[model samples]
Target: MAIESEVLVIGGGLAGITSALAAADAGADTRLVSYKQSTLRNASGLVDVLGYTPGGDGPVVDPFDAIPSLPDAHPYRTVGVDTVRDAMAFFDTHAPRYQGHHTDANALVPTHGGTVKPTARYPASAAAGLASDDRDTLLVGFETLPDFNADHAAAHLESAGVPFDVHGVTVPFPGDLRAGAKVTRYAGLLDANPRVSVD
Candidate 1:
């Protein structure tokens, strides 16, 4: 088959789709193709600018401030800080309204795992979960769902020794969870089970 466009983007991942849309927005006819699937379907849905470097220390507080300390050939340095800012701006213009801590500070966001990681921008749904000294929170997990570990997460937050209280609860899954089942099935149960969310 023959497909024609001013701009052709290979890969239907997040990057490809964004680039295609951007090109179209810039008045260019764009076409995107992927052999397998978009990587977005397998992503954690968190947007992080930079995490710890190879064998480096803990997560970054202010990614921009730590940029200078990175190797001279780092990708962020190569892209230039302005480019990163522009990308963030473009994303914020879309859905979720990506937000951060202060102007250049990274926000603390919960991961699928038990740990809290730093993200340059996060969805508004996770804003309140950011690490703070005065936010009492509850972490809940499903018994059959392996995506989240409530006990480990709640314990980790408490061990941080912050001035906040953490509680963890393990609840049974509303739907039948089978081996190798997709995570979306679990999420569908939550959306369908009015008793769970409305309580």
Candidate 2:
């Protein structure tokens, strides 16, 4: 079979997906191709614009402000700040679950590794967990999943000088899945049983 597309985007990662979507939105026949699973499959789903500069002086407070200072050879510099802003706006319009574009400042999001990352856009569900929000937060980790240690994450957040009181708790998951199960397996189980509760 022969396939024809006005815009053929290679790969299925975030950049490719965004390009394909943009083309489609512009009334073009777009096609996306990927050899393997999407890289987003293992991603945290956060849209990071610029986290830090090459100097590694500190986290970026505003991606737009920092982008100009990036090295000339950097992708952001080559694309220009306005193009980056447009790309983020396009992402915001397509991804309704993500909340961003209201401000130029970056939001500090707590990661599973207990480290806080600065991102321009993030899932709406994680709004409460932003380090800028000065509310007591509780991080819950699964006892079966050894990759994330909630208590350790909380301690790390505190040590990093977060503006909120954070605590961690390890709880048993209400399922028969083994401790060594992959994240996809856990996600599948949860999708199959949304009401699964720990007694």
Q: Model 2, 21-118: lDDT tens per residue? A: 98899888988999889969889989988888888856889889988888999999999999998888888889988986789998999898778999
Number of backbone-clashing residue pairs for each candidate, in the order shown? 0, 0
TM-score for candidate 2, please give it.
0.89
TM-score of each: 0.81, 0.89
Colliding residue pairs in candidate 1: none
Task: Write down the lDDT that model 1 would get.
Answer: 0.74
Clashing pairs in 2: none
Residues forming the 10-long window of minimal summed lDDT in candidate 1: 94-103
lDDT of candidate 2 at residue 41, scale 0 to 100: 88
Identify the runs in model 2 with alpha carbons over 4 angstroms from their true place. 1-5, 191-195
Candidate number achieving the greatest lDDT relative to the actual structure: 2
Q: State each model's CA lDDT, in order.
A: 0.74, 0.87
